[model samples]
Target: MNPKISDFGLARTFGGNQIESNTNRVVGTYGYMAPEYAGNGIFSIKSDVYSFGVLVLEIVSGEKNRGFVHEEHSNNLIGHAWELQNEGRSMELVAKCLGESINVSQVLRSIHVGLLCVQRHPEDRPTMPSVIMMLGGEGPLPSPKEPGFYVGNSTQGFYDGSYGISSNSEPSITKLNGT
Candidate 1:
């Protein structure tokens, strides 16, 4: 029973020994929802991790990646974090409230870890164990691969029906083994 989490709004009631139940009502903060949970009604521990990751990035950077905008760059907070991290200047990502009390390296490390947690691919995202281990400095973390749906590719388009090429508009090509 974590005292901090015991009073969360999303918390629900359950039988003392029951495990794996369903819910008729789906309710939570929008930006905090996992894709599957929001799309469907599924909920799990990993959903909580995704929300926590969002919270962490927001806490450290004082910015919401979901709607972050910069006058100089088109990239979101995840992209900004990646760029700053790649350039070895991650301290720029930290919130001003912490001031000099925050450790630059640790803050950067947390940003990296948070980015990894919120990766678009659920399988690519680390399990809670990995996330906990990362925060606790338990073992060497794996290098995060590029985030999915990376911005600025014209060929790729929306998550909805936005970029499909009509077959009627193009001739099909048949390649022969010898020709």
Candidate 2:
């Protein structure tokens, strides 16, 4: 039993022996949810790991994943962090206010671990125990692969009921009844 996790709000209810489960209805804060849980109602310990990674990134960057957007890029906070890491500028991800006050190595490791937790595949994520080790620098960390919800070069636009065509007036509606 992990004393560290016993005090928090658990997202799932199941027997102690159950390792994973499925549901038809998905529930939780979307921004922190794992893709498998969000898209297929699959829930497990790894889902919690994914959420933890998101929280770490949010804490370090002082940005919310759901609504975060870089002025020059269409990626969210996760994507932005991945980009920064890829560009050899992960330090840029730290909030300006934390400058020089935070331990640089610790923050970078946190970012790396966060990215690992949010890997596109559930199996790619480290177990919670593994996460703790990685964060504590117990051993050399693995290179994080591409993360979930990367959404590269996405464009923002509004879509009305008219679809792509611009129509100020409402279109005629047609209903069919098979009586």
List the global CA lDDT of all models: 0.57, 0.71
Q: Could you tally the backbone clashes for each prediction?
A: 0, 0
TM-score of each: 0.61, 0.78
* Model 2 clashing residue pairs (backbone): none
lDDT of 1 by residue, 40-117 (tens): 445555555666666777889998766677777666566566667667787888988888887766777788788776
Off by over 4 Å in 1: 1-27, 36-44, 148-179
- In candidate 2, what are the lDDT values of residues 10-112, reduced to their tens digit? 3346555556777655556646767666555667777888888899999999888977768997777888899999898999999998868899989999999
Provide the lDDT at 118 for model 2: 83
TM-score of candidate 2 against the unseen true structure: 0.78
Q: Model 1: how far is 136 from its true place, Å?
A: 1.2
